[model samples]
Target: MKAIYLESINAPFVLIEKEKPTAGPGEAVVQVKAAALNHRDVYIQYGRYFTKEYPAILGSDGAGIVTEVGAGVAPDWVSKEVVLDPSTDWGDNPGVHSKEYKVLGMPQEGTFAEYVKVPATNLHEKPAHLSFEQAAALPLAGVTAWRTLFTKCALQPGEKVLITGIGGGVALAALQFAVALGAQVWVTSSSEEKIEKAKALGATGGINYKTENWGKALKADVGGIDVSIDGAAGEGFVQLVKVANPAGRIGMYGGTTGMIGQINPAEIFWKQLNIYGSTMGTNQDFAAMMAFVREKKVTPVVDSTFRLEETEHAMRYMEAGKQFGKIVLRVG
Candidate 1:
């Protein structure tokens, strides 16, 4: 099997031939057809995120065909096309994950290889409407967005919703899901072009956050938003607060821009707004996300596809913050 191995933090990804892994008990070996890049992968590469080991494979989102089933696994799983739920050991709590919870990749070998092994329970039939590349794009980002909007915030149809930093995968997935659910969605992006692109994907409108008074502009132009999904939590976070309606719901997943500064406590309590922190979701969340994707015929926005060996180029592209959607790697 050919795999991209990271020898250490900040080390270059090396494509090397390695022994194919066999399915362990309750696991299956998947012949990876495609893998997708996430911001978490970049963070791991830079040694900024969770990683307890070196010489590791680094990918969390994948779609492929099951080639082998381990002992105790159903033989019927073999030969079935599947997408992996990267979230593992989510435990019993619906509202929170246990200490045992972890996402794939990092300490465990991941999908950036010709073959990768995962628990049989983590596999779901790929949505028929999506190709391998698109299915690969959905798992991490789609589940996160689904849990953030539907589970955490409980967004309703016809509500005015805003998604911050619209070009990234999770944010774009939220935009798509909210729009499909009949919410009037708005977005923010530093790039006017990306904003227009988001609008083409069903966003009601968007704003360039680089402009002065953009938050006020949103409040004045679009009116107060009933829900806001945010990833970047630096300087612009106050803007999201400014644009929220009374009793608005805000769900945050990542703080990509760094720590937030200078927020008014009065705005939160006086407005009776609710804010929730979210991350990669549970197995049930993954299932619901897939069902929604299938029901809505949602297609993940794939910005580019690179061959398996082109791992560095894909990482660089994602690091440059230039992608309008998920970046996929063709594995098989």
Candidate 2:
């Protein structure tokens, strides 16, 4: 098999000949047709993520075909077109994942190769409306957005939404889902061009967060936000609160900007705000999200696509934070 083997932390992605893996019990081998990059892959490369182990594969989102099924797996799975659910071991609880929960592409081998093995349960039929590249972009970002919005915040059709950092995969997925659900959506981005792109995708309005007091400006301009979504949490997090309407809900999936600074207690308590910390979704969430995608015809935005061998360049592009959607690596 040809694979991008990360020999060590911070090593460049160099495709090399490697042994292809066979499926284990209850597992299946996917011949990767397309895969997508996430910020997690970048952090893992620099030894900045939870696991420092190297000599591993790094990828989270992929769409492909089942080539083989392991012992106890149904033979019928072979030749099925599928997208992988990157989240695993979510356990019985919906409110939180078990201690054993993990997103694919770290300690476990991932989808950055010609063939990758995953639990058969993680295989989902690709949404009929999506291409391999589009399906590859959907799994991780789509489920994260779905759980954060409808599951955590219970966003309603007529409610207003504010999605911070508009251009990234997860943020764009949330924007598309919210728009499809008939919500009035707003967004924030460092790039005016990205803001414009979000508008083209159905966002009602947006603001350049680089401006001083941009959140306050957004609140003033848009009246009040009924729901807010964020990934970067830093001193500026208070701004999300500033723009939120009373009883507004804010769902945060990541803290890329490090620890959040102080927020006014009154704003949270008096307004009865709900702040939820979220991560990857459960099995149930993944199924529900895929159904939503099928019903809504939501397409995962692709900023660009590169050949699988251009892994390093694609990683650099995502790290630059300049893309307006998911970056795909065409495999197979």
Candidate 3:
């Protein structure tokens, strides 16, 4: 099997031949067809993640055909096309993950290889509406978006939702999910081009955060937003608070822009607004996300595709923050 090995933090990825992985008990070996890049992968390369293990395979999102199943696993799983959940060891608690929870692609070997092993419980049938590349894009970003909108915020139809940093995969997935659920979607992006692209994907309109007083602009132009899904938690987060309606829910998934400088306590307390923090998601969240994708026929946005050996290039593209959607790697 061919895999991209990250020798160490800040080291370049090396494409090398390696022994194919086999299924252990309760696990299955997937012959990977495609893999997608996430910000986590980039963070791992830059030594920004919690784990510092070296010579690791780095990818979390993948879709492929099952080639083998371990003892105690159902034989029927073989020859099935499935997408990997990548969220491993999510414990019993529904509201939050246990200490045992860990995402794939760090301490564990991941999908940036011809073969990768995963727990059978983590597999979901590939959505009929998506191809291998598109299926690979959905697991991480789709689950994050799903948990943010439906689980944490409980976004409803016909409501106004705002997704900040519209070009990233998770934000784009949120846009798709909200639009399909009959919500009026709006977005914020530093790039006007990305904002226009988001509008083409069903966003009502968008604002460029680079503009001074953009938060006031949103409040003036769009009235008040019922929900704000934000990944960047810098000063712009205050903008989200400004545009939110009273009792609006704010879901924070990532703090890409670093610490928030200031926030008005009165705005939150007086408005009775709710703020929630979300990560990847639980197993139940993954299941419901896939069901929604299948039922809604949602297609994940694919910005581009690179060959498996081009994993380094894919990572660099994602690091540049130039992609409007998921950047996938063709594996098999």
Candidate 4:
């Protein structure tokens, strides 16, 4: 088997041949077909959230076939096509990262390999409509968007949502999901090209984060948003807070713009606004999201595909924000 191994922080991934791993009890060995990049991978490479573990396989989202299942695993799992559910819990406990759970690709070996093993519980049936690459793109981003809107905010039809940072996979999924649910969606991106892409994807309108006052522009276009999905948590979160309707919700997920922010407690109090923080969703949420995708014909936005050996270049593309959507690595 060939796999990607990261030796240290900010280092290039090394492609090496290794022995294939077998499944353990209650686990399944996935013959990885495709793996996708996440901003979290960049952070792990930079030693942000994950520790520097040499020879680590760094990827969380993947789609593949179950080649082997260990003892105690259901016999029906054999040869089943599946995608991983990256989140361990739906927030029955507070905090996305704690001692309770760790996302794949960080603390544990990930799917950037010919084969990877995980608990059978993490596997979800892959929709026949999706190719291996597209299936790989959905697990992390799709699950996060699902938890943010459906679980955390309980976003409803006819409401308005402001989704920031248009090009990432999650933002695209959020926009598509909101639109599918009959919500009016507005998007923001620094790139005009990305803004146009968002509009073409059913966004009512969008603002170029490079030039326009997105917050004020959103207010003008939609009056105010019932919910603001802020993937970029820097100055943009403050603006997301600014554009929310009274008693509206702000779903804070990632920190593409950096984590720390200046937030006004008074506005939150006076407006009776609610802030919900979410990450990748629970197993149940993953199932619901997949069902929705299958039913609604929702397609994940895929920017590019690379062979497993090209993992290094894919990481560079994601870090540079050169890709419009998820950059995937076809493993086998």
For residues 61-177, write the lDDT of model 1, one tens digit per residue.
Answer: 999999999999999999999999998888999999999898888777999999999999999998898999999999999999999999999999999999999989999999999
lDDT of 4 by residue, 1-332 (tens): 99999988878898998889888898889999999999888878888874566658889999999999999989899899998887653446534545556788876789999998888888888989999999999998998998899889999999998898888989999999999999999888888888889888899988876554467776876789998887888767777877889999999888867865688788789999999989887677788999999998888999999999998888888888867889999897
TM-score each candidate: 0.98, 0.98, 0.98, 0.94
Q: Considering TM-score, which of the candidate structures 1 and 4 is the better prediction for this target?
A: 1
Error (Å) of candidate 3 at residue 275 is 0.5
Scored by lDDT, model 3 comes in at 0.93
Clash count for each candidate, listed in order shown? 0, 0, 0, 0
What's the lDDT for candidate 4?
A: 0.86
Could you tell which candidate, 3 or 4, scores higher by TM-score?
A: 3
The runs of at least 3 residues in candidate 1 whose Cα sits more than 4 Å from the true structure, single-residue gaps closed, are: none
lDDT of 2 by residue, 1-332 (tens): 88887889889988888888899899999999999999989988898888777788889999999999999999999999999999888888889999888888887888889899999999999988899999999999999999999999999999999999899988999999999999999999988899999999999999988889888899889899999999998966999999999999999998878889888899999999999998889999999999999999898999999988999999998998889899999997
Rank by lDDT (best first): 3, 1, 2, 4
In model 2, what are the clashing residue pairs, if there are any? none
* Per-model C-alpha RMSD: 0.9, 1.1, 0.9, 1.9
Q: How accurate locally is residue 136 in candidate 1, as Cα lDDT from 0 to 100?
A: 96
Q: Which ten residues in a row are the worst by lDDT in model 1?
A: 46-55
Model 3 alpha-carbon drift over 4 Å, by segment = none
Better of 2 and 4 by TM-score: 2
Give candidate 3's total backbone clashes.
Answer: 0
Worst 10 residues of 3 by lDDT: 98-107
